[model samples]
Target: MLKEALAFKRPLIFADSFFVNKPERVEMILFLMSLCLLVYNLDQRELRNSLKRAKTGVKSQICKLTDYHTLRFI
Candidate 1:
């Protein structure tokens, strides 16, 4: 549903509540969406590993927050 809209170059404004409530699903969807965008732009790679991780379906179901965050210090 959302993917279809985004695929057609339509504007998308996902509410924070959506991701907040379904962190894992949201991340998985985001990763898949990125793959679609990559294919559309003709820049794709084998992200099978990441895809596998997403299938676990157990993320921030309790707190409605992302389970992890990373920072790069350079």
Candidate 2:
């Protein structure tokens, strides 16, 4: 995901640099739309990974706590 973002960054920066001088309304709007889409997708991907990690961590901790309680009772 980081690699993909890095790959995308170069072209986006180049396009912005190219258009920054002329400052056309339509081009700027399009650029903004594309940037928003890229950011949204990247955010979603990162959120999913974070949630997955949290879930796995919670499961492991729960298992450990359960084992500890069982041992104490025994």
Candidate 3:
């Protein structure tokens, strides 16, 4: 999700220096970031699917029961 991509603060910071000094390295940095996000999302999807199949929910930050889990929750 766009929110997940935007929430990646530390990776952006880590890739900042590379963008300014070695432009070519930017591709690799972006690739790695994308890969990490993909993995995170896939895992989240699996968790949500599993929970749904089990017909259960978890408490969110606000203490309300939710079937959909966000990155912040897990």
Choose the strongest candidate by TM-score.
3
lDDT of 3: 0.76
Top lDDT model: 3
Error of 1 at 49 (Å): 30
Per-residue lDDT of 4-61 in model 2, one digit per residue for the tens? 4345465435545543445587687778867976776666656556656665422233
RMSD of each: 15.4, 14.1, 3.0
How far does residue 45 in candidate 1 sit from its true spot (Å)?
A: 15
Off by over 4 Å in 1: 1-21, 43-74
What is candidate 3's lDDT per residue for 1-74, written digit by digit as tens? 68755674655355344434576666777788789878878888899998899999999889988889966568
How many clashes in each structure?
Answer: 0, 0, 0
19 Cα displacement, candidate 3 (Å): 5.8
TM-scores for the candidates? 0.32, 0.42, 0.72
Candidate 1 Cα deviation (angstroms), residue 10:
1.3
Which residue pairs in model 3 clash with each other? Answer: none
- Worst lDDT run of 10 residues, candidate 3, spans 11-20
